[model samples]
Target: MDNTKIAVIGAGKIGGAIAIALKNNNLKVKATCRTEKRLKELKSLGLD
Candidate 1:
């Protein structure tokens, strides 16, 4: 567990959920989505 950094590609529903769950566990989580709308949603979920 040296690097806890996580990147969620194609962050739709499942991706977003996984990212948020990881984030909740105090891991560094980043997510990418196809649309700006979903991107903002991911950001609102406290993901980078």
Candidate 2:
């Protein structure tokens, strides 16, 4: 089982940064936002 778990809500400037940083370090992360645009942006940034 994957022990790394991180939930970063509101994928804005700061939130996106945190999510990406965690993912880059080999952790599981899920970033969400209130808009489709932001969600797409987060997906493009490599978040599932």
Give the per-residue lDDT digits (tens) of candidate 2, residues 1-48: 368788998878899999999999988899888888889989998896
Error of 2 at 10 (Å): 1.2
Please list the residue runs of candidate 1 whose C-alpha ends up more than 4 Å from where it truly belongs after superposition: 1-3
lDDT of each: 0.86, 0.88
Candidate 2: where is the Cα deviation over 4 Å? none
Q: Per-residue CA lDDT of candidate 1, range 1-48, in tens?
A: 546899989889988888888888889988889999998888887889
Residue 25 lDDT (model 1):
88
Taking all chains together, the TM-score of candidate 1 against the true structure is: 0.88
Question: What lDDT does candidate 2 reach at residue 44?
Answer: 90
TM per prediction: 0.88, 0.84
**Number of clashing residue pairs in every model?**
0, 0
